[model samples]
Target: MMFMKSIFALAAFATAVYAQSVTIAAPVEGTSVTAGQNFTVDIARPNTLSPSQEVAVVIGLVSCSEAPFNGNCASFDVSQIFGTILYNGPYTPTLHNGPSPDFIDFYQNFTLTVPSWFTPGSASLNVAHVSLIGAGPFPDLEVKNITLNVVAA
Candidate 1:
């Protein structure tokens, strides 16, 4: 009986540890574009455990400059145009001490309404990290992925 009780306690602890993680999938990059063309960027969060918990996503337009070193690029002049909180609907599962109980999905579309201010060349559509807070015991959360591209309009 004592051995059986210890095994059960261990299983419960492991389940709790696995239940509290928030994962943000990568954003799919759209194709090339003209200066005045309308473009759409699809941002998806396929899996979210704590959908009840709030998160802030900041999207910006930035210029990527090549560095002296190989395989390295630098970003500059981050212009913030879109920043908002994603509210996972009530049907979305709340983190109750295990991996996200349900799959959460959403998207955002951006059009190039601003006039050209930079030289004719290539730039990047950057999605800053997803900021997660007040979710269980985790103090903060951040995730990074590849930057998308935008041509001169």
Candidate 2:
């Protein structure tokens, strides 16, 4: 009976440790922008959640739809930005062990610096997807397919 009880306890603990999730809320669908301006993306935890959380975002640049049909679609260079946030409560310097409240907010901003030789037209800002790892007492999570459009200067 003692061994059986210990197995059950371990299972329950595993479930609790894998219950957290993260979400990306905005820059909204179909957002538009002009060159030389800043674009914003927002991240949050669902209202149904009740635990402190942490996440990192990576941003990248890709070719616009109007690129020549034969143009190297995969040739575009990629860049990354890093950010972290504490949700729905006061910020804590330490990871985990923070108080929980209603929602946690994070943002990623991208701006285009047009090269003097480039022409003015439309391009795409791809949010290379969100990755949630190292979650404590929470499920590992991910959000994908977020993107925006910009008109070159």
Candidate 1 wrongly placed segments (more than 4 Å): 1-30, 65-104, 110-115, 133-149
Q: Tell me the tens digit of each residue's lDDT in model 1 across 29-103.
A: 434544445554444433334422435444444334333212222333233322121222221323232235463
Q: Which stretches of candidate 2 lie above 4 Å from their native place?
A: 1-21, 48-52, 66-143
Alpha carbon lDDT of residue 116, candidate 2?
Answer: 31
Worst 10 residues of 2 by lDDT: 82-91
All candidates' lDDT scores?
0.39, 0.39
- Across residues 1-153, which tens digit of lDDT does each residue of candidate 2 receive? 999999997886555434333334455645665545545544433332334344444443333443441233333433332111112222112222214554333333333343333333333333333233333543343333333454565
Question: How many angstroms is residue 130 displaced in model 1 relative to the true structure, after the best TM-score fit?
Answer: 3.6
Clashing pairs in 1: 18-99, 19-97, 19-98, 19-99, 35-153, 49-100
